[model samples]
Target: MSKTEKISELKTNKTRKVAFMFNDELWQLFKQTCETNKTKPTWEIEKWILNYLDKNNALD
Candidate 1:
């Protein structure tokens, strides 16, 4: 198989780590919003980042 095919066939069971810092009030608000929506803040953030990347064509 070619490099592109090999790369495409690759799968990972690993997860990446990331960190962020924000205002205490903003964090509280974010937590509350996630709880009210019955979802996790991390999940919401991941969805938001994916949407943003897709909109900007950053994934390409």
Candidate 2:
């Protein structure tokens, strides 16, 4: 898909809420990293979780 389509999909699909506790300094760092990558922190965290699951063969 094109980048615009993907961005629209992300915007439309962010209808759910996920809550977690994040440390002050660490959360700031994560926010900066997400800004650097031009993505939301939630998306980055989702990618991290998916990668871990895939690497551990736990995606099934």
Candidate 3:
């Protein structure tokens, strides 16, 4: 499949919600990081958590 097709396929999968809590200072830091990286902090953090879980095989 092409990149667009693969992305569309992924988009069709069910997504789960994950909530995070951080102090105001940490939140500001996260916002700055997101702005510098030109991406949503939440999405970046979620991807990081998923990668960590996959690497450790902890999701099972």
**What residue pairs clash in candidate 1, if any at all?**
none
For residues 1-60, write the lDDT of model 1, one tens digit per residue.
654453343322226777899999999999999999999998788768657765786555
| Best candidate, TM-score | 1
TM-score of 3: 0.59
Residue-level lDDT tens digits of model 2 in 1-60: 654565456556767787899899999998998899899987777778667765786554
What value does the lDDT take at residue 15 in candidate 1?
69
Lowest summed lDDT across 10 adjacent residues in model 3 is found at 2-11
Steric clash count of candidate 3 = 0
Off by over 4 Å in 1: 1-14
In model 1, the worst 10-residue window by lDDT is 5-14
Ranking by TM-score: 1, 2, 3
- The global C-alpha lDDT for each of the candidates, from Candidate 1 onward, is 0.71, 0.74, 0.71
Winner by lDDT between candidate 2 and candidate 1: 2
Taking all chains together, each candidate's TM-score versus the true structure is 0.70, 0.63, 0.59
Runs with alpha carbons beyond 4 Å of true place in candidate 3: 1-18, 58-60
